[model samples]
Target: MNFYAIKAIYLFEMSRTFRTITQSLLAPVISTILYFVVFGSAIGSKIQTIEGISYGVFIVPGLVMLSVLMQSITNASFAIYFPKFIGTINELLSAPVSTLDIIIGYIGAAATKSFSIGILILLTAHLFVPLNIIHPFYMISFLLLTCFTFCLFGFIIGLWAKNFEQLNLVPMLIITPLVFLGGSFYSISMLPLFWQKLSMFNPVVYLISGFRWTFFNVSDFSFTISLIATISFATLCLIIIFYMFKTSYKIRT
Candidate 1:
């Protein structure tokens, strides 16, 4: 692989993110605040604790995960889309860069953006509410892993998208709904037996469960199970992305 080419692509994409750093950082933070105010103050009283933590505290991981996931998808999608929009994707394909190099360059940029925003939101949360991360390493690791996995998923979305409207459809239509229903605001235990079982089908549930577990040292699913689910989704995303790049699905015509 051409290391120089990879760095060039990665650095260029990173610079693009910096151009809109204010928007990127603030948007998620603001949205997180809205969630906290509405859910924490208004509804938290009605709901009780999960795993010995307040409802507000329990939901933090899910909110953070939602932010990380959305940022990864949008950042990676834009990174891929800019080249197509500016007619540079053809040049990139013709360049000597390997597919792996291209994939890593874009995915790294996406993960970086997501990580930055995730940390910023956490910092913001500290001001309005207190949080505890019992196992710091596990917390950071899971967050980073989720960012990487979703970054790859974003690349696939970028490759599949032909226009700007199509670009946001997946994140808005599919991912957003999944996050809301993924037990971000409420624990699965609060659901009826049937809905509790049904909630298991949503992948984001595992992500939240694992993240919250790191905070309080308690989780609905075992940490091992959560890690396996994350790895599984990531592997599936990698395979799909590889196939898309190999065929140049919407990338090359």
Candidate 2:
């Protein structure tokens, strides 16, 4: 409803992204290139393909997902956390903006950054390996969903965090590890049966698996289950965000 308020917050966050171009964009681009170099050259040699796709190409979806997830969280979390850290959140709170406006502004900007990096990375992947999208619609659907979901999740992290260190905690310690173990570099099928069973417990696996399927029509789990898991997780994040705003959890403190 408050279009101007949303636009102002969105543009402000976008400007901040441009200001930190090196860290926000270039850093992830460089890191993804390194991953391609190391994994594509070294591991890709021993393993030519997984699920009938070349090892280098097979990992592209997962790599993009990994970068997008981390970027979304990092950007959104830092964007809000900085304002809170510097005591400017109160300014926004006092403004004529609804919680919906604020969340949409921040979350939209964060998702845009994350998704932009993801598209760039996808283009960058073409340089290292030939790629194809068997299902463009499915691919974009999953891409948008993942970007929006994680960005919202990151917004929640921003609200819950009390300091810079805490802002970095989940992405560094939890999300990143989940992604690596979630079949970013290799398929879960390559794991031992016991480890395979355990891998099912990791939620990131479903996301990566489902996204990978859109590319090669291959997945570690059922496509339906992956879709369900992703929607379920996003729903949970949305619920938490509503509760946080309604109760003023950490927002008024």
User: Which candidate leads the pack in lDDT?
Assistant: 2
RMSD of 1: 1.2
For all candidates in order, the CA lDDT equals: 0.88, 0.90
Provide the global lDDT of candidate 1 against the true structure: 0.88
Candidate 2 residue lDDT tens string, 99-172: 78988999999999999999999989889999988888998889988998999899899999988888989999
lDDT of 1 by residue, 13-66 (tens): 888778988887888989999988999878987888876788888788888998
Q: What's the true lDDT of residue 79 in model 1?
A: 88
Q: By TM-score, how accurate is candidate 2?
A: 0.97
